[model samples]
Target: MDFRLTDDQRALQAGMRTLLAARYPRERLRAAVDAPHGRSEVLGTQEGAGAPGVHGAAEPAVDRRLWAALGETGFFALRLPEEDGGAGLGLPEAVLLFEEAGRALLPGPLAATQLAAGLVPGAADGTRIVTALDGPGVTAHLASADAVLLLTGDTARLLPVEGGTGPRALAAAPFRSVDPLTPLHRVRELPSPARTAALGPAADAARLRREAALLTAAQQLGSARATLALAVSHARHRTQFGRPVGSFQAVQHLCAQMLVRTDLARAGVYAASLTEAPAEIMGAKLLADSAAIRNARDCLQVHGGLGFTWEADIHLHLKRAWVRACQWQSTEESEEFLANELLMDAAGENAPGVWWDTLGEENVQA
Candidate 1:
């Protein structure tokens, strides 16, 4: 399939970039990072306010104004059906928007909320924030999330965080996260004796997981691209020994390597967005994760000692990349999954025989 973006897609991507650059400037991102952690100015509480038996500390509220602006721009509603009041776009468009969000370091439960748009009430409009988790270990943005989408094997459940009275509840506890922009809550109990509302069956849940992984890969792609630009910019402007650092062979090589990795990951992500196959999505996640993490580290190296300071934005991108690497799918996990898939495909392709016997004499000897 063609991986190139259409003209309309390019326009959409440019529009998203413009919106994020205007709304989520570097200063705003710094403010969010430096904001008080425990202060709550919105929904959900430290206590078991939603479900009587569930409890957890309150997290910092999301930027309501910025969220509203995104909603008005149809960010969250991009993939929802037109009849349901959405932009009536597909996953490709959603991926483009998410890429811009990642580049801007726009905080909040963006992917979860976008995935929840049509499934959960108010999610399409951004009036309600939603976060999701698979099998409930640690979830992001739970305190501010109006609802939590719980993905179990072959099924999904919606747990309201603010005003849930269902028989089932999610017991949460405060957990420290490497990324300050992403608040986390550990879900100790989930989908108890009585299950929450079932939003979709096995097939839909599978689709959700695929989309989630692809979208997350897109975010990693964005971060990788952004850090590459930063590294290139710094190398060009920063002077060392009366000469621009970018002119040095070592710095040029680092920038080139970063660019290569970013482009390779971008290709994987774009192709997966179109294919939506399990292997493709997993491969994309792996490539994107590596690109984001390594590019940030390389960018830091290019920046030298100045990159380690809290004042610089390099560390923030690094931290967010680390956090995202664990989200949806971790590096090790994706590797294992991809490996298993390859093995499965090989097994399927080989004629009926002992798998080991099908190999060449060199392989057999090994």
Candidate 2:
């Protein structure tokens, strides 16, 4: 099937790129990382302060201004109902927006906030920066979020940061993050949440996890594509033995391999975005992780000494990709799940290796 984007989707992608290029430029990203507080100050006052549900303290790790920019574009409201003051879009649109965000290296608790819309106070209007903790991983942008959600199984516990409604946080401080753009912290224990909501039935947790994985996979796609371009550019310009590195067969093959990995990942992620089956989602996540990690490494290899330097942004993408790969789902877990899925299909279904289509849709409501 032809996987071309629709005219509207193309317009959406281009608009996102244009906005991000103007707001979250490379210079702004570095400045935020190098800033004293790990990010720029709150951009402005909340759009609707003193309203019944408004809380003006939900500044994210990036410039709250940028979050406001996203709010202006209805970024957080993408998946919400139009009757409930949202854009009334779907997961497909969200994944595409995230792909652009990843390419620009925009940083924040985007997934958490988008998921939190309409569920938590001030969440939908970008008045609240929401962050979530699932499994045993370091939560990013902890300092910026006004509310924290402890995601366990099919339940989400809302923990408000102010008025002592939040969990027993270890004294509100930012942990030094490997990816400076996305700061994180260690939580020893969380007592309980202020409010709780059932995520839904039918492996909703896994489905939500899959949705997160898909967006993250989009980020990985962006990272892979960016690094591929970086490597190819370096190959064309950088010379060795009085000739451009592109002339070398070894470098050519390395770039070719990177391209192959990226394209495969793109295909898988787009496909999984449509199906959203755990098996398909896991497959997409696995391919995305591999592409991002491998492409960054290959990009680094092509960049050689410059890539290794602290000044180089190549290492940043690689580190972030590494961190992102392990979030929500791990490579080991996804591999096992896919293996079992294949096994079940082979043992019980029509035949072994039935081309992955007969595995059945999870019908997960993400």
Q: Write the per-residue lDDT of candidate 2 for residues 100-154, one digit (tens) a residue.
A: 8877777887888888776776777777788777754567766567777667656
- lDDT for model 1: 0.78
TM-scores, each model vs. reference: 0.87, 0.82
Each candidate: RMSD to true structure?
Answer: 5.6, 7.6
Clashing pairs in 2: none
Evaluated at residue 42, the lDDT of candidate 2 is: 26
- Candidate 2's TM-score reads 0.82
**lDDT (CA) per prediction:** 0.78, 0.73
Q: Which parts of model 2 are misplaced by more than 4 Å?
A: 36-60, 163-176, 193-204, 349-366
Best by TM-score: 1
